[model samples]
Target: MDRIGLTTVVFRNRFASTKPKNQVLEDELTLLSTPEYFVDRFKVHNVEMWTPHFESTSKNYLKELKRSLKKERCKLINLQSEGKFDPSDPLEENRLKAVIEVKNWVDVAKSLQCEAVRVKSMKKSYSKAVLSLNEITKYAKAKGITILIENHSDLFSDYKNHTNIIKDVPLNNIGLLADFGNYSSNPVMFDSLKHIAPFTRLVSAKTKDFSNQMEHIPYDFQKCIGIFEASGYQGIYSCEQWGKANPNYDYEKITDWMIDNIKESI
Candidate 1:
């Protein structure tokens, strides 16, 4: 927590208990602002905010964000440029839409004083996402944008494929935002984290609710830290806490505990 720059996500589903959007947004800020007050809290800033619930290609979307970013505590934003899971989009149209959306995001990120915007390397349709990404990477220099891809489910099945895509794109500005637990659903989590960290410009320090589990879960803190260390990864390890929670688990407490355990236990 002390040396690391952190990030938080603002998923609409995470606020389901709150009745109104206004109320939910207010509650989210309260959680954020409290860290500003924590006595022993290290300097924390630069949060990653998601894109619109809709596609970012809308003409008015950039206009709306420009008007609103002034009100939020978002001096820096890790803007996710494309987000479509479930694999239902037509390959050609989706690729075109993503390009336009990323272009719009570049304009907005500059206007909003945002540092970096994340993007997908490509989709399962190798030829399309690859083709589009290559074009974007070529143009990215003039645009002053860097693309950071997560090991997002389905988009990247393994490190070999992921590394190949990074190679094909050939942009020094482009790199991985290695989500530490991306491969947690598989037996290869640690290895995947190790392999990708060298290419990492950002990292999502993923954690599960050990407190929520009925039995002791096996997450090696030392191994996770070792991967970053061995890779010479000196970048933001943005904590991502996912999966179920229990009645006894305090969300903030869980995060603070992980920061202490994982960082110090190393």
Candidate 2:
């Protein structure tokens, strides 16, 4: 249960987005049909988990997601939304919608029994970052849910920037979803992981096949595990892979290696 788990997206190429719900379901079945050797090896907690596509253009999205969670027999660890929240946007209409949608997402998370929801760390000034998190933290605390920020967009570009946001909120319920194998473009994956490790409520061991990449290489996952341990991070490290190349990447096997590394580093 302490080891990392792969997101459903890893096993399938076509099931990339929200559409074709049946395809997504099919992918889940295919992933579970085997012996799940990796699951046991890595000490994976569960076979099923999802990051509900909350940004789709479809109505009744939340309801569909609720049904999907049950049908898929998976826990929703993260709810990915599209709208950006900005505190310094003097536009009252924009700010109003941002607050309302956050409130609604809280309600949805409660109904779905989801433990965490993903929020974007907006590209705002340092002071604005704190102000923005303050508003988001109030809503999270009220709903009894945790807000985890992904290094999506500009927010994951720097940990120091996010730390400012963290200082402003200063709440247990608001934390980071430490991501790995990402922010490559920004060139600070390891640094970001360490910076967010202490506040991380959930962790993501994001993997990639960079054998063909010109600049960045595939993450030194084992070393990254050491970093997580050094920071005293004990949260789940979800494997969310990108692209079509299937490494047949075994989560259980990798997790076995990573956890062992964690133990050694400490």
Candidate 3:
């Protein structure tokens, strides 16, 4: 059966303090909301955690986290790692660093029993990025976790680039994380989704505002879900509530409403 999940970044503001420029103070938000809180309160059985919201990936810490998830009966669907992942960086050292960092996240994914890890693409180096991702995919395969490439920014927002990366990656363990709200308009967004649907392993349904009819504004949830169904995608539609379209409304309230819309569409 298809299920719904959420990314930790959806509640980023509530997760951490944006006040401190320093990284240390920024992590204070993670302390407030945790895996336990998500499972117990939201009743989400599947979760996609953002790496920045976490402080450590030490063995003991991960062990405890795994224990907590098991206790709550929640599964870690994906681990969204935030770092400099443009393998096509002009500098060789930076490219090397990106690969190493992503590989480390793969290890963490293993510890968390996560099914996939989402990484961003480089706007500069398509070929180099593919090469680097191939290496990451090789490592992820051994750990039994998939490497997911998301259409997050710059060149990645283009559907052609997403398909190119998928075709050139040359790894079976690599796939795309199709995000609904990434594109600028409905036509382009739906077209891009169709292009990458064959490669999609997960979906990030980013919602900002809803209409009075309980439908997602700007982008139609019914049509979006139709595209997913047409593409034969049967996975969690991760509700990622972002953007400040309605600052007056609380995000949790918006999330609840989005969940209802998603249920109706599904």
Ranking 2 against 3 by TM-score, winner: 3
Candidate 1, residues 1-266, lDDT tens digits: the string is 44454444422334333224444343343222422423235344545555543334344755555444444433454666554532222466766777766766666666556667777445467556667667666666566767776777646647766667788788776777777665635358777776777777877666664744432255765567678877776666665566553435455565565566556733
Top-scoring candidate (TM-score): 3
Model 1 score (lDDT) = 0.58
Segments in model 2 whose C-alpha atoms lie over 4 Å from true places: 9-12, 16-75, 84-90, 184-187, 210-216, 243-266
- Whose lDDT is greatest here? 3
Tens digits of per-residue lDDT for model 3, 94-213:
888988888889999998898998875566777778778888899899999999888886567898888887778777888888888777777898888888887788888787676555
Where in model 3 is the C-alpha error above 4 Å? 17-33, 210-215, 245-247
How good is model 1 by TM-score?
0.74
Residue 128 local lDDT, model 2: 49
* Predicted structure 2: clash tally: 2
Question: Model 2, residue 251: what's the lDDT?
Answer: 36
True-structure Cα RMSD, model 1: 5.1
What's the best-to-worst order under TM-score? 3, 1, 2
RMSD of 3: 3.2
Where is model 1 more than 4 Å wrong at Cα? 10-26, 30-42, 52-77, 82-90, 120-123, 184-186, 212-218, 245-248
